[model samples]
Target chain A: MTPDIIYSGAGMVVFAMGLYGVIASAHILRKLVAINIMGIGVFMLLIATAHHDTLIDPVPHAMVLTGIVVAVAGTALCLWLAVVIRGLEHDAASHPSQ
Target chain B: MSPMLFVDGLLASGAIALALLSLNAREVFTSIVLFVCLGLLATLIWARLGAWDVAIAEAAIGAGLTGALLLAARHRLREPTSRDDTPAARRPHVS
Candidate 1:
């Protein structure tokens, strides 16, 4: 098999694993990580498929770059929300209203 | 098989393994560490695929920056009690 095929297959596996992670994890942080993994897997598949057409394609590379930035921003926002929720949880636990 | 294909196989498997391990990890910290490693291996995969630009971006922003963000979040989640223990608790500042 060719390298593209191998990498693409791996990408599919990663995508599946990421999906499973997102489903299994209860914590918001872990879910965010899984979402990022799923994004990377999609990028990997895109690049690999693009490679099959040519050794390298500038378009897919550009897309991956854009995707990375989006992933980071999304993760940051999610993290902020997680911290907020945790703070709320702590407050509720410490100060119970009768 | 060519050396390149062998390397590709190795990187792909390593990436996949790390991804799986990270997701399966019970501790969020361990999962985050493994995820960082997976991101680095993914950078290598991009390089091997001849996408040097993506490789660089993955290494810097993907693995490096994202890892920092995750660690910071983890730290925030783990240390909620520290404020209660320290002298900072004495000062009743407006929330």
Candidate 2:
């Protein structure tokens, strides 16, 4: 059993668990966290694939770096949207005529 | 098994366990904190998997920045409003 396969298998399990969280959780923030976890799982799998017995591949590493940045950006955007919507809901609920 | 292999397995399981715990945590704060720990574990796993660059990125962006963002958002989300936001209070609208 190679280390690469072990890591990738774990990654897949993580991804599945994240998927479950996203579906099962009702809270918007928790959904965002689950999505981030899913992204991390994918990055882990990519990292495993990049490693070799002789030479490590640079491409997957680069991909993971960029993916990390993008994932953070996406999460930030989602959080912003959620907060905004919450504010709107509060406002509407407080003043029904508005 | 070689020590290194066992270590890698340990790290992988740790990461997975953290993810699961964070997702299922009863409190939002607890879950967010656990997510940060997961990110740290993932950063170490990146290094163990021989991706030094990705490790740094995960530590800084994944763990550090993401944790900060989540904490801030959680704080904003928990702000008190004029009306109670609980499901029981809002049930009249659903019916």
Q: Which ten residues in a row have the lowest lDDT in candidate 2 chain A?
A: A1-10
Candidate 1 off by > 4 Å? A52-55, B81-95
Instruction: Considering chain A alone, report the TM-score of candidate 2 relative to the true chain A.
Output: 0.97
Question: Global lDDT of each model?
Answer: 0.85, 0.88
lDDT of 2 at A69: 94
lDDT of 1 by residue, A1-98 (tens): 38889899999999999999999898877898898899889988988876854456689889988999989998999898887888888878888992
C-alpha RMSD over true interface residues, model 1: 1.7
lDDT of 2 by residue, B14-43 (tens): 988999899989998888899999999998
